[model samples]
Target: MTKPAYIAITQHTKNSKPALVYVPTRKHAGLTALDLCAYSSVEGGVAPFLLGSEDEMDAFTRGVQDETLKNTLKCGVGYLHQGLSELDQELVTNLFLSGRIQVCVASSTMCWGRLLPVHLVVVMGTQYYDGRENARKDYRIADLLQMMGHANRPLQDNSGKCVILCHAPRKEYYKRFLYEAFPVESNLHHFLHDRMNAEVVAGVVENKQDAVDYLTWTFMYRRLTKNPNYYNLQGVSHRHLSDHLSELVETVLNDQVWADFR
Candidate 1:
């Protein structure tokens, strides 16, 4: 899939608006934003912000010093990655919330936990962990929800802006999982399997698999009661648990934005 050049574009308005662009890397993409504004028809301006060390900011702000590429970077404008002081972080949060900054080119670290509302939170791609024995690594579903929550804020339009998923099918599939997984009352430990994941299915069940089975059946039974045509299945398995849980996801998606929020 083709990754878009820009993660998000901000619309300027009377209200101060801040935009958050989530990129996989800090240095390369942050600087690229500065370069894109030079040639592209895209409006507003792009500024780069770095999150690591302070010494790197000088060369970064100056752009590539090579004589060949110097002229191309002359028009570049954006924040550089000076280490974020606590006050600096607070200030960025405020600027973002107030919409003062037109475009913020930030590392995913900028989103470590800050919940600044924006038009869109575009996740371009992610790092993969490859070990010698096995090569499999991915972001946890809860982590993705936490990232997406930055956009699910109280909106000026009253109608919320759409959370768009582009290019990546894996990301889209996770998005659907998150939408279904949102409303349920579960903590980080529960979602991650660190804590016991239990549901009061029917009378009572104490074993983990039994609890999972009961809970899964209970959720599906509730959905079938509401709309019999939603889905049909003969049995369940660890492999297809997500497919079965999807019906509950549909109910949760429209039932409320978040039970906690309400």
Candidate 2:
């Protein structure tokens, strides 16, 4: 006998009158909401699905003078916000797990470890870079993996029915970049040295001077030896930071500043 696949049911009512399409790109995120209004204006009866936060909905509702959007589409559109408490998370998860809301527009963060039955997953620009001081950082592959799990589920009648919409330029996007940011998890070293570089080197930094020296040498290697090659280690640059390093810096800096003031 075959094991049953994951099936979700909820008390949330489905709006079968229309379909909901979630967009990930900021350029087109609002298109679904706007198009619904446009279609409603001409068609007269069919309502379009609108997905946004309450604040977003409010702003668009107030900004647009379109009668169909303001009245009809606005009523059809649903708002989803991350301001949910733990209790609210359970409620929303139940709604999703139970298949209550027909359409939802959400950030990728919402997909992390969430059990929701979604018909589609859309990915926008994966290359989100942050420039801070003299550093540049790329979005983590772990972060992308977390979002991609939105489409993964046990095989069922509708389990493989999910569709992933990506940008035209990103037709092979996932293949190229899904594992870019997660070098360790993505087994990048295996790809580079074919398991020759799989060995992990452990060291003990006995003192603050040792830690600082390691960082200084790493900085020099990255600047002089590696040249254009980008290397980020904790305390070397804000570009890449581990949780412990971030906390340690914050604690030390705050303590020193406070002590100096006193």
Candidate 3:
């Protein structure tokens, strides 16, 4: 990720256009920014990202709390994440937009939070920890798309650039999906019990029949008929639909029965 990122920074620096780098976590965001600065110096880069003098740079980074981030900024790089204060976020964001900094590294979740646009974008990694599932999981296509969007600056640059660094095994997977418009299967089943419980608490579901009826008006129900294979339906028959909904209601109610035991 740092190799490709350094290359990106080198290429864009010649044109004086800023770039954004996305990492998997807040820690990676800070470290990747620092590494990019290191790569710059090792390769005889005068910190191309730092466009201002030391006094001006110090004024720009007044209230920044993260020491590593401050150092990166001095090298003409900035970092963003949820851990930073709003004041610091706004400061870094302004630095990027005003072209004082040439690069900003951010966490995956920050893709939606900040609206920083650049001539280039490099996704450090595609996987992030899913606390709910207690495992590392691939990023949602929506979030990845949003990250890619940062590269294109409308009416400013003729074109945009993106470099995604993912595992070799998933190369083809990303290549296919990035260009193809595949149908999105319903993920309701992943947390059907929790969803059903919410509805029950809201008085929208009162009985077993009510629960099944609720599923009928869902995206899951729509996809059930279109892609029966995805939801593991044996056949697209009335009996099959009824059986599936019945099983779903049973699972949801059973979970509610044991909700507090664990």
Candidate 4:
């Protein structure tokens, strides 16, 4: 078979509404945006937003010190990631949402509840680093679904497109995984200490029992409660509850001043 091009462009929208290309890492996202911009046409001009008039676009372009990013912006492609400043992020997001930018290349962090009416979502990979697992892992089906959900806007007449590009080895994996919907697993354990500290400091929970009560109201708690078998918890037993509480309390006590609590 003939080798394919490094980058491919597919058009789904007639008006060039914003589209997202999701890469696995910040570096990949930046490189992809630069590649796309460098390969694409000037007719697909960049969008720069300023509080004032069109002249501000020139000013904004001049202000960007990164020559690569500045040039990419001129080509109507922008990259977004946690590394970018809040102002830069907002500028890219606003321009994309307003249909001024044709494509926004971003890492998977962009998928978390930041709704952009993108006409297409090109997911470049099926794996990401999992800090909890201490290794890279394939994305769960639920996460892929959530990411794909960003492609389509309910208000739009035309349905959006989600394309996942993976190596041949993982092709069957994605097929099987995406064939059926998977329920999202709880991740509250990751945030237990932070939530506990905030609730205690805010006086929303006075005691351990109050903390448990507050947690029970969370979606994670409800999922655990409803599907105890799935979690292997064997029901919301006192032992399991205490184990969770102990973990949270230990984390908080280690990081915070106990005397300040009173």
Candidate 5:
């Protein structure tokens, strides 16, 4: 018997319709977008026009200092990232959503909440930069799932595809992470201090008890409580929580209060 081209479905559901397209990096995204444009032009006919007016597209093309990227845009390919101006990002996103652009080379920033119902989603890399660690690390299961969710739009198409491309060493890891449906781990502990401080500064919470009570109602709290063993936070003492809360209170109280002199 001949072997199959791809592996058998491990954990896919009827509702999970996104085709995950994974590449290695932002550079790969660009290359892949160009390749897609080339293929589409040859197989699918002329490329669609960009979303904006000719003048707007011209300005955008000129504004891009990267000559190669500018030329790519002419081929109906675009990229999205925080580095681009808000207008540029919006234009690219709109173009992709309208199907005016064949492919969009985007960073993970596009994966959050923006709804671009594309037939395919290509994840360039499985690892993202970890600011805390000052190094690139594998994406968490939640983030990987969230990115894939962007591609699976049942309203537009009953099914979509997400392709993930990773290095050979990391291929098995990606397979396990995607095929096994790993549970999402919470990062509240990493952001707890910053969140409390911001809440105190914004006047969202007044006291330590208020902070604790407020957190208890959040989804993170509920999830963590339910899976304490997996999270390993069962031993988080009240004293530690109180200390962090008290520090937040002090910082907020000490800050200069803005007032209207009038």
Candidate 6:
């Protein structure tokens, strides 16, 4: 992955376009950034990925607290993870967008929340271990898409590219998912009863119609017609949707949680 990332860094740097690399964890983000930096360094010293003059590089690292991070930045590499302060995240992000940084390696959970003008994006790995689940989970489909999406810069470049590194068995899986449009479905129904109970207690919802009406204002309601079968609906008519919601409301009101409200 780093070999490809190294190639991307070298190529994109020549075009004056930023590149992005997505890793699975905070530790991976830092290490990958430094590894890429070293790949382009001169005689074991940080030499590639750096931007601007010595004085400018000196000023860039002056207030940065992490010594390794400071050095990485001098090499024009930045790492971001969920642990960073909001201000620090913003600083690194701004630098990347403004061409002050050549490459940024970020963890899956650390989305920069901005449209990047990068020409290359690399997904170093496809799975991360989840402590709570006690297992390794594939990167969420949406997250993988978002990470890859950064390779494009609408007006900045004529084209963009993304390299995805995953286990051999999962290559087909990613090819199918990434090349196809993955639909995003709402999960609001999973916790609708709890939410309905709260609104009922707060006098925001009174009966079945009120509950159904409340759902109409939610994203799930908007998707009813689009994915009626996913929600277990036999028909996609307004009446059918209303009947389902009414049934749901009745069921919720009978649950142990809503007993007191009734």
Best by TM-score: 3
lDDT of each: 0.43, 0.39, 0.87, 0.68, 0.58, 0.79
Q: Determine which window of 10 residues in candidate 3 has minimal summed lDDT.
A: 7-16
lDDT tens per residue, model 3, 42-146? 885687678778789998776788788888899998999999888888889998899888889999999999788888888988999988989999999899999
User: What is the per-residue lDDT of model 5 for residues 107-140, given as tens digits with 9 covering 90 to 100?
Assistant: 6655664666655665666777767989988877
Residue lDDT tens for model 6, 1-262: 7877787566655655788888999999888988887787853255556655667868767877777788788878888887776766777887788787778888887655656658888888889999997999998877887887787878678888888888999999888885687777888889987798789889989877888889889999888889988888879887898788888777877784566666
Sorted by lDDT (best first), the order is 3, 6, 4, 5, 1, 2
Candidate 2 residue runs with Cα over 4 Å from true position: 1-45, 48-81, 84-92, 127-139, 153-158, 161-170, 176-262
Off by over 4 Å in 1: 1-17, 39-83, 128-136, 162-172, 178-262
Candidate 6 — worst ten consecutive residues by lDDT sum?
Answer: 42-51
Model 6, global lDDT: 0.79
lDDT of 3: 0.87
lDDT of 2 by residue, 1-262 (tens): 0000001101112333212233333224344445444554455354323333445445544644333324432434322335434543454344344443334444444555455545444344444324354543433657665555555445522432333344466557665664355332222211322211122123434444444344334333344223223323344344444343344334544554587699
TM-score per candidate, in order? Answer: 0.44, 0.38, 0.71, 0.59, 0.51, 0.68
Q: Per-residue CA lDDT of candidate 4, range 56-169, in tens? A: 455656766556666666666777888877777777777677655577888887678467667677788779888787998887767788788878777774687777887799
Which one is best on lDDT? 3
lDDT accuracy of residue 236 in candidate 2: 39
C-alpha-based local distance difference test score of model 4: 0.68
What lDDT score is found at residue 176 in candidate 5?
86
Model 3 misplaced regions, further than 4 Å: 184-262
Of the candidates numbered 1 and 4, which has the greater lDDT value? 4
Off by over 4 Å in 6: 11-14, 42-46, 85-87, 112-115, 181-262
